[model samples]
Target: MPDSVLYSAELPAFDRATGQLSLAAHHLISAPLSFLDLSPPGSTLLFDQPPAHPYQQPVLVDDQPRRKRRRTALPSADASPADFAALRDKRDRQTTTDRESDEHHAGIALDLRAALEAVQQGWAGRARDEGWVGARDDARVQWRLREAQDERPELDLVGLAAAQERQTVETPVRLEPPRAHLSAAQLFNRLVLNDSSSSSTTVDVGIETSRVEPAPPALAALLFPPRSGFLMSDLSTWSAPSSGIAALGHAKGGWDVVVIDPPWPNASASRSSSYETFDAYDLWNLDLPALLGDKPALVAVWLTNRVKFRRLVKDKLFASWRIKGTAEWWWVKVAADTGEPVWPLDATHRRCYEGLLVGHYIPPGTKNVALPTIPQGKVFLSTPVGHSRKPVILDLLRPYLPSPERAPNVLELFARMTLAGPRAPSIDPLPPPEEGKAGTPPRCGFYLAVGNEAVKFNVLEREGGAVRGWIRQSGLEKAEAAACVPEGQDVERM
Candidate 1:
């Protein structure tokens, strides 16, 4: 993302099967803009449950009132003996496995803090001028602030869920609709790699839509939106290659590094309705080996804090996909305001850090490609942005690649950054196109966002003169409890 000029432009995903492109998946989102807002909300405790130890230290939040804990209903004094026994049994029913996992993770956080502090001590002086790349002391801190207004889109679309899971059907089966018109491979191929080292380039793929969608007879808004919802004429009008995006040629080759980020199932994400989450099988459908070009490439997966989620990737997914596992790294979220972890380091039920699993994906019969051995237990500190979006760590992982001269071709399996750019004060808005015509691309400053729903986060307005905000973020917003698993009972980090 270095030396790139990100512009506010529409990202059009293409389907080679029908040779059509659509923006429906990345269209106007009706969800709360607060989660996507540039301003970080007042930090609150993610877990309300008491810490594992009886003598746990009190946590005092900064610039915010302490939240009163919700009281559990107690058994009345007149209740039967049987009722009292049941209540006591339920209280002590936490499984042995759960207790062990919680204890294990609590220890892991302590070690991670120690390791991060060591790295910070070494890089503290140099990091002051450039920004907090790794870690820092009391010199400077970056706080997220939000602008008060709305940036509404004049366009919208609806599409079918496409997935038919085995879950039991209700009286009327409800399928969560999909966002893209193209398959993953087709979309990945169509992604434009714009390196603005010499000159800044922006390719706007603007299309026209009716002022208000004429509702179809099938209840398209309430039900699965039909595939026939889009017209061929609605696709972006593409000119010659060099005229729009020049360096798009490299997206074809087998990627030297493939980063797989799935929408892992999360309890918190479900309750919040921020975005949709999918099962692990949905991720398995993507043939991992096929994506990596015939070379000894590196593969990394962003993991949630849960042991089950970690095991799914490290145990089954990696081995089955032929990505020989190597090492693991932890991305600890630091609060820009406090220069401390967003969550308490020793909080029993929540973790400030998430997991990253890496490996050298050298398949059988491939030789002479000497990929570097990834060091184990690595940690990086960076402030969180926009609701637990994973920070850009490709630069950190680049060192593990076999060769530095040949900048590795990186492919993100699941990307959700906004493709739209920030409009500068001097720029004028392009006239909206007629209902059937493709419009001119808007002129604006931008962030380099590529992948699915890349425009979903566009609603966020920028903060002026803020120091050390994250540059690039890919995917993964998992929120399980600190450790242990029973599924469907975890909290999230905001």
Candidate 2:
């Protein structure tokens, strides 16, 4: 019989609920491409075999081994300094692996060449889309150089500075935040009208009035009726009146869940006085209508700390979306060693937590879904902070995800570039056809969990065509034979 224990022993899955660890689910999601270190690991396993395999099985190997995990070998008194250096290098390598594992529960890598090409194309496309011609050619060149690492690994700051210096004209700043006194309503109107002309706006409310309106019809139709009368916008975009007020009016279809992460413009250090920040209006202006335009759903917004943003989200954003209050979930990220802020012997710094405010966009005269009430008893557990930290909505919130998995669509409005690995394909918000050119598609499409965004995947071969032995990627010298998929077997892009 073929070895059932297929693939390498690199992947491991941990079940926090049962305190169990087992082999990761694996099938064809494996690729030889090396992602220069940014992609999330795609689903490393699949449910192809019978469910008879022992899952959640933990090995009791060295259950209580007396050896210390962080032990250093002391040098002999007569040992040379070089001997100590050699031993230290070996120890460092071992220690770093452990740290990396703890940091990345699900590790994934992307092909370096593919990643570089993506970056180059990503910058170039954005520049073209935004009419930023001055930066396109130079940016692509710089990226190529960086990818090759011919001379330097750092981005060519000098070339960029030179290109920027060559620009003869200056961009006009017309829509500065209003200096004169303006009522909240007028300020809101100006913001909505001036979004395209200017990238930044601030609303200074004077004598705020209760001008909240009803949810939009399009939004209501998309979601099943909510328990309350409003929908809250995510924190970053909750500043606009349109963002956090009652829905604009009814929508088309009803929804079960809405996940939003607004991009409140985070200004990096060393920037000028003002920069582009995504206000509530910018985020919700298009999507709110699109989402509520379809279905009424339970909505979840990830938020950072900011008192003004918070109040706007709760009172204004939620009210506008027509999503009523449900419950709040706090996502706490703590290092394994450093328990909490008040704990002693804490080594890590700048550990912060986020909040996931859950609400529902209810429609008028709609009945609420009845279910058993389960208290969130001790739901305040903590985990380590992963990059691009969002609540691990899988365990508690998986039920909200669409089941029967037929082209289940999801959208992340304010997403960064796609990460590789298990959650990769599903995390984006565009569809395969619209993601890229007809032939040159993005690899992120291989991540299959999401469908609403512009996603691109390699067509290893035309559907129903003869199978080959290997596949050829870009930057390669010759065409490779395609992997042979058994007759009628699904050959998903890895």
Candidate 3:
């Protein structure tokens, strides 16, 4: 078993204004702007012609003469009974055609067409309000909008149709209750009342609830793997129940494993885009209690040397999940040419170390002492050529990952795809939510690494701990002393 080590250093103060640098910690960012298109429902629509007026007449082209009818002799008077039946069928067909024409002209068909026309008009009004100048005519524009709406896989046709009806027919659109500030007491009460609750309650806390926080330092390749946010998808295979943060929900029950690298909220940094920030309410409005409602068997959370955030993970996050502190490890990365005297031994000065905060959430009243790893007592170290290079040696921890005592159910949260194992499937990040019909590709998530030492991930270093240390040594304290001490106190002043 790896022993947990606590750091005595205070968390470094950092500036959040500049995101390319890791002011203090590694932050997990969800690119919502890129995922916006994933919100609409359904497959794309194929529209060959635009909507026209209901009464528009079909244009008639120059027509050829109809073929002359064949004439039969007096033998027709002696025709078989089959011939009479054919004549009767022809009469019925003619009568049905007449009835269809009559139905089309009646009030019902006209009413349906009028409703469609009103829907188009309503959509046009909305587009103008939103400043989306799409398409020419009101009807055509609305169709294009609907086509766009259909792109999100999460949006069902029925829900969309209902939304359309409400937008047009219902005079006002007001938000419903559970505007997300439900107290802990309220939540506990609800849980108790519904003791045998099987499913999680979904209250639409609007997009506004998320407050953007500062962006973490940049990585070599930032990836936003969008998966189907299916309520029923089993998440236990990857993330542990307690490892989940406020933005991304946690895994409940015994997750096979939980892996996370959080953007510690240490510095007073702010971000321009909501997606870039770590604590923007968009990411933090998560229901922590609900996420850890069940005990997580295995967990691994990434931490920084930042003192405040480390305390937060220990006191707040862990306590809520009912997980006990187990082992802590440092991921040490040094430059390959670390021995060169021209540069300092620790040439990779910027992001040299990351702390892995590992723990386990046991069931109520269970006395299970976690055993040590086979090779223990020594710290694990690796030389990472890239930024955020996690040691593959950590894979040794895979075996102890928990399975259900009786039946097997697993979930993993905030994960990337790993090579698949035979029995267990790799449930990494889901696909991005679908968007509207425009087919415009979302913006790129990874910024290209530029310059010479860019390969060494140096530009991402923030001027924090070391830089602050240098500033403190620059003699502001000595200058203050000169002003404070009386001139006569220094008798040597003569």
Best by TM-score: 1
- Please write out the lDDT profile of model 2 over residues 1-494, one tens digit for every residue: 01111111123445445576654322110111111111211111100111111222234567853533323457789999997998888667765445553242222111212222232343343333422112122211111121232231222212222333222111211223221222322322111211111111222223333463542211000000001111112233323334422122221113334566654444431143211235545444443534445344556777654445555676677777676644454443322222221111111222233456776556545675442222121122232222342322423443343331211222333432122111112234445554565432222111111111101111111223232101112232121222222111233531
Runs of candidate 2 exceeding 4 Å displacement: 1-256, 265-277, 280-290, 336-351, 371-387, 400-408, 417-494
From the highest TM-score down, the ranking of the candidates is: 1, 2, 3
Residue-by-residue lDDT tens digits, candidate 1, 92-201: 89676666567658656655777555544544554445333222221212223345232433112112122212122112111122221222112121333222111211
Clashing pairs in 1: 6-446, 8-420, 8-421, 25-179, 254-293, 349-482, 417-454, 418-454, 419-454
**Span of ten consecutive residues with least summed lDDT in model 1:** 226-235
CA lDDT, every model vs. true structure: 0.41, 0.30, 0.28
What C-alpha lDDT does candidate 3 achieve relative to the native structure? 0.28
Candidate with top lDDT is 1
Residue 395 displacement (Å), model 3: 0.9
Q: TM-score for every candidate vs. truth?
A: 0.52, 0.33, 0.30
Tell me the alpha-carbon RMSD of every candidate.
18.5, 21.2, 32.9
Better of 1 and 2 by lDDT: 1
Candidate 2, poorest ten consecutive residues by summed lDDT: 219-228
Superposed Cα deviation of residue 209, candidate 1 (Å): 6.9
Q: Of 2 and 3, which scores higher on TM-score?
A: 2
> How good is model 3 by TM-score?
0.30
State the number of backbone clashes in model 2.
89
The total number of steric clashes, by the backbone 3 Å criterion, in model 1 comes to 9
- Name the better of 1 and 3 by lDDT: 1
